[model samples]
Target: METQNYIEYELVDSVSDRNIMTDSREEAIHAFEKGWTVYEHHNTINQHSKFTQSNLTVTMMWNDNPEFQGS
Candidate 1:
């Protein structure tokens, strides 16, 4: 028996509300650097130990919206 773990990253654009999912951390970080919101998903499973877990974390990265600027 062996333990297994899986991880995923989600990038969402604030203005367009579009999103992309990937397993590559580099890609996620690239998107985050470009002002996209990032979310991490982690899943762990161990049949031998009867253990399972899932977690989600959000990293909010946003740029100032020009439309929201005070006149």
Candidate 2:
């Protein structure tokens, strides 16, 4: 059977413009708690190889607030 794998979430830090991909929701939430904005990535899953397994991708985005820069 042919299958597709895609990103599940997107996380980015506006303050540092840093980004990362995850497979679970917990990780995304953790990044958000740290001031990172998290987004859900909706896409098709890629096909898995006979010897390799498919994985999910989560993204997060976080922006530093100007008012909370000093704190």
Clashing pairs in 1: none
Residue 33 lDDT (model 2):
69
TM-scores vs. true structure, each candidate: 0.57, 0.49
Q: After superposing candidate 2, which stretches have Cα over 4 Å from the reference?
A: 2-7, 45-71
Clashes of each: 0, 24
Q: What is the C-alpha lDDT profile of model 2 across 5-66, one tens digit per residue?
A: 55454566889978776767788767766767665554553311111112322222223233
Whole-model lDDT per candidate = 0.55, 0.50
Write the residue-wise lDDT of candidate 1 on 1-71 in tens digits: 96568767667787998878788988877787787866565555211111112322322222223332212
RMSD of 1: 13.3
Note each model's CA RMSD in angstroms. 13.3, 13.1
